[model samples]
Target: MSSDIAQPTTATGHARQYGDRALQTLLSANRALLRAEQVNALYQEMCRIIVETGGYAMAWIGIARHDPGRSVDAVAHYGDRDGYLRDLRISWADVANGRGPTGTAIRTESVQINHDFECNPRMEPWRERARSHGYRSSLSIPLRDERAVFGALTLYAREPDAFDGAELELLNQLAEDLSHGVRHLRLRQEHAHNARLLRRSLFATIEALTVALEKKDPFTAGHQRRVSRLSARIARELGVSDFDIEGIRIAAQLHDVGMIQVPSELLVKTGPLTPDDYDLIRRHARAGFDILEPIDFPWPVAEMVHQHHERIDGGGYPRGLRGERILLGARIIAVADTAVAMNTAKPYRETPGPDATLQALRDGRGTAYDPAVVDACLHLLRDLREAA
Candidate 1:
């Protein structure tokens, strides 16, 4: 691509113009790094800024591969309107093709400037390709990680000696900043991957505990699972974010964890529970909180479990939190748990069925249950019925 800028009449004017482009490129590079979220995005933006903002004819980024061929993979480019790199094949090995600006820059871990791509003997391999693309000069800057150079940012200019001392200084600084951006983004990506792995492990452990509890109490065998499913659905209908929905689902699955501390006989008893027995069962919420409070969860899992039994009217649970004071996840779980429990059959009572469960939620909306959660749950149940 042509530089497409007015040609300066004097040598002084030329140098001044070059300096301005370099400064603009550096500023744009800084902004790109701050806004960039991934390494590939950074590479693509760097090339684009160098071409459009710096007034380079063409620009591209190539990663040096350590495979058998030691090939340079052209990962990102701009201003290649003619597809200049379409059939490009280059390497970093000590071979003929590897002696070009991009390969040499990576090999030497320094900047490589081909002042005159037409006359330079080292440009023999790519000379024709360069001429065909109207590239008179080129600059290649090595991109490095914490350890060593891993890639090259190559730029082509319409004028010979386009990259002079002042411009070269700024371009070199841009390359350094680009390298740092790449390293930072890669580390962030790796950290996110590790965090996901750890979260999965934690979920597995929670699932095991839930399974053990279910095994101990046959009456509530699949109650937690049903609650988890309904809670997640209600959260989605309420437009809760994916991250918060995951937390709600997990909390709902483990909300009954406190019952493990209660006597198995009391849990399985078909007879009416005495007031003391009822109070003991009420203690399960706090017990579940204590069981989960020590674990380092990314979400408010312990608090959600503790507040699952809470009511919006400040009439329920250990703390009696009112209105918005109750955690949203817990509020969602409360609606789901109540609905699932009423619908599911128990040894001590007959199943109330879905119609009765919906009526119960409608009756308690706003006073006992969160109005919005009840609305979302009502919509979800309607959809389920329609789908059925």
Candidate 2:
């Protein structure tokens, strides 16, 4: 170390020089913090504001690492660094290397200051570089939250004993503000991640339920899934919004869920159903609505299930909802359900080809089915044929 030592300086002189700039730094950072949406941008701009507005020689934010090594990594920096970090190593351990302002502030959870770089024994390793860079003083203020200290904001100045008691207190308040910012960003990221996980879980559970229904009725093994795919395709072709399309697809998958309550023998009877059996089968739509109403779905799923069998001409089962009174999701599921059912074999009728299904849709476009849905379904089917 050199012979130059920092004597007790006049508090009034240092306070007068930096008081105005310190207040401005705090105000500027608070403004930027209000609009910061990401972590990197928040710290990088913070470093810039501190060095440019606060009149500091250099400023950096160092975050502590505990797993691999007890080292402080300088994540964000502004102003002149001048190779100061190339030969410098600081830790929060109880050793000589951890005695510097940065390390001491982090370890002790308080402000650490080196009023003189050339003569201070704690800053001996940095004296030569500090002298060449015209830096005479350093301040390390801990970045803390409610629980513990996570890092430190290390700053340098050209004047000896530049940071007085008043300045240190102001800097501490700035560090606390940064801690709140970091906490806010972390909570937002965690919430978004959790939302994605919840959606995935809900989808897996619903798909499993649909599969179980398929196993119970072997003749309709993949009927619901096929109707779901077709319903989604028609909705997209009709220019339905993504949100409604998702609801339509989900509703189609579970539209026949009430069939589970029907007797298994009646499902594969291979003959026309008796009046009693027909009545039980007709009650399936209402039964499905009751079973699904208890669960809180994001969409109008239960209502769609209850309305899927209703006709637009007041000629269809359970409740004969006519015209535009039927829900859009229910309407889409109806078209897809009829098309797939006509194509597949059933106890009541033999399987018809795709052309026959199209003919049925053409004949009943406005009377039974919604005209727009029929048109969209036809368009999608025609495109697939042309592409093939």
Candidate 3:
């Protein structure tokens, strides 16, 4: 819980400094996994944790780069790195620089350790760089997920022969923890991306259907759009969760979509519809339900559309879904639909304005409309008026 996690003051002497450093490093990685939101930030913090908590002189992470060059790019570093991280062009190719622990770890997908960095033959090329930075012993451990190796974490110690069997074992666990954190972040990002693409496809599909309906009934060109907006507001006012609110909006957007099956002349008819014509007009609800049932929507969009015209008193048509039998989404859409329709001019009647619409809603609070939905609609009307 403490912010200063680098040093845990348990003992007074050299024992506390070196003996407990590995435990602190492991704890630091666990803390970073909780705090860091993404992979790049996680790696950067891991490098810092090794230097500050693990008692290492320096630490850096190198991710494998393909395509233009089969080389390693030092993505994260902590401690004294004037231009060393940028200048060190280590590669997986069988060459002088490639033989070092960093390149070797990446190529072999295994941990590479140099207990004597100054005397090792493979350390000859970058010996001066290592010596100037006070690094005498080094550890290059591959950071890997279950499937494959992604990168390497290179740690430098101040003393020679720093990494014995116990130290190596502890550091390997730290590497594994870092791999798990990175993999979790990548998976989260992939899932978010996929969800966004799926939503886009759903929106486009619904919009196409809405447009087709609007073209058939030119008088109601943007009626569906308005209903969708109102439904979303009403749902939000009712304290609906985000996912269910989207379903309400989508269903409301295509609420009258069954009208596309009716004759075009009947839709634009300015006179009162005959009994036979009214029956045909009402059939659109079932038609819309049939149309939407095949599409795999995450929400119950089809059922909401089918029941949107139903009354709480069981008098309204298309299934006469009464009381609790009607979906909550349909109830919210019902209030939104009536509010919008009453306030807007129709081919058969003049516009009643918002005040008249609210009056009608208040009069029919329970019998015709869901009382909860009506109250939410009333609050929204007041909010809209205040905003205006």
Candidate 4:
């Protein structure tokens, strides 16, 4: 009889140890899942695990409004079909504001555990909705960063007393994991948004500068746009990656940004240029570099613009960089700018036809331009003519 009692006692101890190990494993997995910097991914994983573990019939996460006075927003929902989730946008006003479990949890910064929703006074109004959805009990755990409450993770179960002390503890751990993930994701998204805005502002400033330069030299009107279009075509023909092609297009559009600093009289003068005027013209590249050096850009757009006047044979100005030493984007823009200049009417020359322009490029191939880029430009023009 004593041996039987001892065996049962030992079995209970082992069972408790196994349960503790299982809880640790679950917490570790939750922590790992929450490290993802995507809010939707974190929410989906959390919901799937809770449903699989019989912790919930459905789950949802709501983010508090960015405005201090506004209602929270439902950002993530699980256990609902795609179409249903789309219509799950809820407002704090829709609930008895700060009355339901979720609202109460968020407002009080505590978990609202409804083991028996039918008898719970706090859940009285929400009881019918829960029952109609086949949820008899629910738990709402407040999600918080170090500073303050941000939202709540609400879990619904189909049976009463579904969440015991152990399950509530586990939910609390999951909530902490989720809060950290949410904070990280929000920060990343904000950074990306700010970057996009900064890039747009820089592009707008470049366009304004180009327009001002064009006004000073009416003969150069439409020059930057045409160069950008032609450069993009050449990049495509060369099978350059789309990212580099975009860089070339931007560089081409701003290639002559330094011309903004040149004297208007020097630009519009129809007479022959003095050596001093020529010198002023040569200074535009460095002027452009100086203007752009301070602005933060994702790529070396300023440097590419500065080098657009450079030649492959070590003959170009400002830096006189040679061959592959010049950025590929700068080389592509150089060919495009030269081609456009040769084919378009300028203050100093007549507009040559496309055939004459191609011949000139072929003649000056290695001396003034990158040979491979020139070949690509010729091929691009042929394709355009054929398409036309």
* Tens digit per residue, CA lDDT, model 2, 93-189: 7678787788888888878878888668767877888899899888888887667898988889888777766666677778789889988887887
| Candidate 4, superposed: residue stretches over 4 Å from native | 1-49, 52-55, 62-100, 118-134, 383-388
TM-score of 3: 0.90
Q: List TM-score per model, in order.
A: 0.81, 0.79, 0.90, 0.78
- Please give, for residues 1-388, the per-residue lDDT of candidate 1 as tens digits: 1121223232656887898899999999999999999898889999899988999999999999999989999999999999989987889988887988888889888788787766777777777888998998888999999899999999999888787767878998999999999999999999999998998899898989899899889888888988899999999998899999998999999999999999988988887888998899999999999999999987899999999999999999999999899999999999988888887767677888778888899999989999999998888787433211
Q: Model 4 over residues 291-378: C-alpha lDDT tens digits?
A: 8878776568899988988998999988889988999889989888877887667676567767777888898799889999999888
Predictions in order: lDDT? 0.88, 0.82, 0.82, 0.74
TM-score of 1: 0.81
Error of 2 at 110 (Å): 2.3
RMSD of each: 5.0, 4.4, 5.7, 6.9
The reply for model 2, stretches above 4 Å from the true place, is 1-35, 48-57, 65-71, 78-83, 86-89, 129-134, 158-173, 322-325, 383-388
Which candidate number maximizes TM-score? 3
Q: Tens-digit lDDT track for model 3 on 33-124?
A: 98878888888899899988887988999888774556888888998556657567888656677778887888788777776656776677
lDDT of 2 at 65: 80
lDDT of 1: 0.88
How many angstroms is residue 116 displaced in model 4 relative to the true structure, after the best TM-score fit?
2.9
The Cα RMSD in angstroms, rounded to one decimal, for candidate 1 relative to the true structure is 5.0
For model 4, what is the C-alpha lDDT against the true structure?
0.74
Ranked candidates (TM-score, high to low): 3, 1, 2, 4
Model 1, residue pairs in steric clash: none
Using lDDT, rank the candidates from best to worst.
Answer: 1, 2, 3, 4
